[model samples]
Target chain A: MGNLRERLKAFYADYSFYILPVMKFALALGIYVLINNRLGYMEALNRLFILVILAAISAILPFNATVMIGIALIVAHCFGLGVETGLFALVLYVVLVLLYFRFVPRDALVMLMTPVAGILHMEAVVPLCLGLVRGPESALSAACGLVSWQFVEIVHDEIAPLKEADAGMLNVLQSIPASLFSPKLLLCVIASAAATVLVALIVRHMTTYTRLRAVIAGAVLYLVIMLAGGVAVGVELNAPAIVAGTAASAAVALFLNMFVYSVDYRQSRFIQFEDDDYYYYVKAIPKMRAGGAKPVRYYDDSSRQNGTGTPVNGQDVDGVDFKTKLEDSLKDL
Target chain B: MLTKQRLQLMISLADFKQSHINTTMRVTKYYRNDYVAVQLVKNFFVTSIAYLILLGFFAVYHLDFLLTNMNNLKMGRLAAVLLIIYLVMLAVYSVITYVIARIRYARAREKAEDYDQKLDLLANIYREEKQSSGNPFGEDQ
Candidate 1:
């Protein structure tokens, strides 16, 4: 009974950080489907994959303000769709995020990444793994499983009707000839970008330089690929390519980074880095210091006693005398 | 099920906020020795003023372009409808964060009312001082 209780506790502990985010992801998706039966499948699918992976990361790391923000902002940024489509999506994302850290378990890294994670959804790898994992399963099964979670169920039962009414209200709002753009929308974008920077600053507080470097490198690569694709496809930076390119770039960087780590890590720690059919430059050094590998046999003294050879201390040394000393030290006891 | 963990998490957040504020106060005090603090405040003031001016200026500058864009989109009334919906959503998100943060602050104040481990450490420091010099005050000596 005690063991069973402990198992249950562990299970809850493991998944606590993710439950709310995943549920929110589903709620946002459900609303998307309701609004348009033929919802652009690319962005929603990509977001679904990322949601699962980040869910895993959040589960592993300790919960904190940083991680919560990271988790929330990312889910919102990805699935919220375009700027226009994102308005409602963003609200659901924020509420779910708040509820998670409030009502669920948050890991330490989540706390560190909280600020920027939401707006930017900075971790690019979420989609890559999700693609590899979820692509095999039926979309309906995946969607339903996600939607059935407690948070999604709550939204369906409680929030959906209210939102449906809002949708009707939004329809009425359409009749007005008001400007398409408003300071409100522009401010929101600027605010989100600022939030992205803010979250990144907070992330820098907890994460190491190398990981941070990888993150930035991944970002640049993602943008380049996305821009190239956007130009090629004549689509203005769509979700499918952005997510696909970013995920691919991050995976490549994660692999190549092994080659960039310090030699001491390779030698002492014994973590084998694979770059098959590749050769790397190694600098020859005179001595091993600070966790470096000790040289095999570099300590033989050439100076020895010649009865005439002068020594700084008491004894004089010559070549043969040095050889004798070496031999003597090496002799078996 | 979430009750126990929730309480622990909230208390932890309160502890974190208090320590962070204290650290910020100490660092700011020390940093005041440098002229950077003066520069920082001046820069903040200048930026805020600049942003305020631009906020009004840009509101008028882009107002025409935005309305035209809205008029161009032929999505019936949905386009205009969604814009209002977006504003309402933003308002909701902002209100929720502000209220929760305020509530957390109140909870933090209540948590601080109990005896803190900081007091015990300070008492130890006082005791050590008493041993070095026979009590400095005469009333209880």
Candidate 2:
């Protein structure tokens, strides 16, 4: 595992500049393709050539720009359905944008990912991983994403009926607000929000197998809330689908945690100290390093005496001090 | 003409700017009051626009009912409720923006101070080398 980590790190370090653009391209392509698959109302915009060109351009742009493009595509597709549908989508997207930018400008990706996850039947992963990696505040983005996706579903369901009924624009518009605010969507948003906050709290407070516990607890909470709420709202609950999706989401969360934020619990250290202001009890866990137990940096005693070495609670073993530069850097915070 | 050490320092500084200093630079470019106020105003506009959109939808949805009961409806109470909702939303959004802007400004200022100290240290090194009449690519370097 350590050797594989080292090779991956080296490869990333050497090729990140080239790799990042390619990854962005892939993500853009995936998002565009997913959008087209879900709502291919506009035949012109549904072409692979246009999608490729747009995704390629988005790859070179900032991520938020890509999200904006996604929104535009959604609105365009909604417009292709009807003017009432287009207006409804436009207002919804505008409101979402306002709320998202004001509260969580950094989480546009989450907003984009939610609908995609829904389409993939992996929506549970969005909130679970969000809670594991980010703070409770990310729930806002999750909620927005959930609402956006629910709106998509509402549109999908409504499109066929509206077209068949040959409804007037006013009648179509009147039915929109009702469909958009369905009890099922509300319950799902509540479930997602609750799960996100609960997982973040568990991960933040727990010290042992934090990611594992958080993922499990989050998935369970999400399932319980969704199932109970679905029952109360008279919505047909897909028991097997929900369970399978939750399990898959939990596995994905654990996998992401392993690669991105893993630490060695066995090598954890506890340190207690008091200053004039407060007494601090700190539990420091060592990261899973590519070199295993090797000291991150070495400092001779002379360097300390000369005030050249950073002052830290470094543990010395075998004539080498494991540097705690991270502690030193975070001291001010 | 850049010395090897100076060139290395420049590369490090550029890397820092690219990787870490962008948010700091962007935030610290404005005074604290100016930054926070600007964000608050932006939030106000966004909230207003969103509120108006919601109101439009509500009005449209209830257009028939409202028209039928227009004579029976409490116009003043309805207006007051709408105003209160708008104010509450504006207040919530403004407060969030204010807090976020202040926190960002404080962090940016801290980072800017650290960057300035680093620049000062580099300047001092250049001064010391100049005082000693050292070559640009000295043996010590």
Candidate 3:
């Protein structure tokens, strides 16, 4: 595992420029494909060529441009459905943009992550990952993402009725307030914010297996809030899906934590010490390394005179002077 | 004729420039006060436009009731309420933009200072080489 980590690190360091653009392209393509599948109202916009071009452009542009392009695609699809639908989507997106840029401009991707997870029935991963990696402020972005996803779901649900209704502008506009401010959305936003904050808090305070503990706590807290809140609000609860999603989210968070904060807990130690002004207790955990300790051979003048070289266990160092190499290696250290 | 140290410094400088060019260009394009003020005005206009659109939606949603009570409605009070909402939105957005712009400018200034220091170091290296070589342009005569 340590060797794999070292290799991965080296690979990233060597070709990060190419790797980053490839990753951006992949993310952009995935987002565009999902958007087309979920809300492919306009046949022209849904063409493979158009989506690919959009993704390609987003790959080369800044990350925030990708988000903006996604929003534009969603709004375009809404416009294809109906003028009222487009207007509603425009208003909601504008408000979300204002809120996001005004408060958390740095975490633009987080605002998109929640809805994508929701589309995949894995929204729980968002808060868990956010808690593991980001500070408490990220909760706001998660909440915004949840709201956007919930609004999209609402639009999807209301699409048929909207089409059947005669001149649905007034009726649609009237219903917007109630649907957008539903109790379910409120509960979800609260639950997501609470879980993120709690996980971040636990991770901040705890020292041992901090990411692991935080992921578990965040997953549990999110599940509890969602289940309890869903019931109280009379919203039909998908208990199995929620449970499975939370478990999957926890697993994903742990996997990411393994890559980011891999440490040798077996070699961890605690020490107590005192300075002139204060006492301190410190816990130290060794990082995982690709190389184990190399055996250093020491030879005295008497051994050299006897012509008996230092023995290496199960290893060959034939025809090489140990003293010069040892001195050079020590100097490097 | 580049030495190893000089090549390393040049590489570091190039890397820094590549990473910071966008931010450096933006920061240098405008005076600090003008940038922040411009942002504030831009945010104010955006807020005003959004608030107007929201009001239009609200009016459309309540068009039936508003029409029914058209005779009884007080236009002055309604206009005042709308104006108040618009003002509040503008004020909030203005403050947010002000802080964001100031922070962006300060961060850019810090990077610019670091870049300037690197330039100075490179220049000093050239100056030292020229003195040691006893030539005006640090080249063999």
Candidate 4:
């Protein structure tokens, strides 16, 4: 197991330079597809060749720049739906960005996770991941992301219903309040995300089984909150779909923890040492070993064989012990 | 060709750079320990306020439905139950954060102290070396 892990780590280190760019490109493509499918705005812009080119370009850009492009695409989609919708989205996003900069500018990942959560339908994974890799303060960023996602979703839904109707500025503006105050949508998004964050925060701090257990607990909490909130808001529940989605999300979360945040539980060490003036107590935690190639050992047969078939010290040639023979050879030299 | 003013300016610049590095290190240390707790508290308040505002917006806009729901005793009971759950969650979360923060702070302080001791030892060694070499800086004095 250790050898395999070492080999895996070595392989990752060797190929990460290539892998990262590929992953980025793939992620960009996925984001483009998601937005195009979700909004169908800019049908002309959604040509396969253009999307591929844009994805490639996005891959080379910095992460924040990529996110900006993605946001721009979403806004373009909103504009395709209606000018009022697009303007409202732009204003909302500007506000979100300002809040992000003013409070937690470092949490760009959480901000990105907003649209991802909506598209993936796995909002629980965001908090689970953040709790593992970041501090508790990341919850604020997650909340902001959820709100942004909900806002966009509300706008999309409202515009969808009025697609055939005359979607003038006034009509679009009139529909905003209904979408904004839709108790079911707000409650489900907010409550589920908040519950997941709370679950992740508490479970991740536990001494034993932190990441895996947090993922499980977080997924459960998210489902419970979503279901309960749905009930409270009089929304019909889809039990089977929710169960399947939560299960798949938990599995993905587990896989991510294994590959990204794996730790060796057995290699933990506690040491006590003393210097001239102070006693030092240390707890050493070992990270998971990456899989690597097994070491090969070579032996020289001529050294063990002294011109005679019999081995050194009268031991049989076939059963000659290497350590004893080497020691004898060294002593003789 | 180097003037005294240029030398003095160079020395002051070096001093300023060194002080800046030291301040950065100190700030990083504080952030890794004490600032975590502060950030958690701040996040809690900000997230709570944002949630409340969102919920409040919905309630105000849907005042008729909200008032009708509020008249139901079941709604009050449900709110109370939800509130209790939230309170319990908060309590647990606080304890966990406190414990983790304390451990991290202690570890960081220990590392800082060890680093300081090593630095002091290095300084002592350098001083001894200078004295043994007949004090090159002392020659100017």
Q: Best-fitting candidate, measured by TM-score? A: 2
Candidate 3 lDDT by residue in tens digits, A21-111: 8879899989888887888887789898888888889989999888888888888888877788888888888877764565566677766
Scored by lDDT, model 2 comes in at 0.78
Taking the tens digit of each residue's C-alpha lDDT, what string does model 1 give over A17-74?
Answer: 4555554544344333322222232344445555455545554443453245343443
- Pairs in steric clash, model 3: none
Chain A TM-score of model 4 comes to: 0.72
Per-candidate DockQ versus the true complex? Answer: 0.01, 0.30, 0.12, 0.07
Candidate rank order under lDDT: 2, 3, 4, 1
DockQ for model 1? 0.01
TM values, all candidates: 0.24, 0.81, 0.80, 0.57
- Tell me which of candidates 2 and 4 scores higher on lDDT: 2
* Residue ranges of candidate 3 with Cα displaced over 4 Å: A164-167, A260-333, B1-5, B28-31, B136-141
In candidate 4, which residue ranges exceed 4 Å CA deviation? A1-5, A204-206, A263-333, B1-141
lDDT of each residue in B14-133, candidate 1, tens digit only: 444444546344333433324344434443444344444434434444555667787576675765775565555445544544454445444444444332454454345545555656
User: What DockQ does candidate 4 have relative to the true complex?
Assistant: 0.07
Q: List runs of model 1 lying over 4 Å from the truth.
A: A6-40, A44-53, A60-83, A91-333, B1-122, B125-141
Instruction: State how far residue A147 of model 2 sits from its true place (Å).
Output: 0.1
Rank by DockQ, highest first: 2, 3, 4, 1
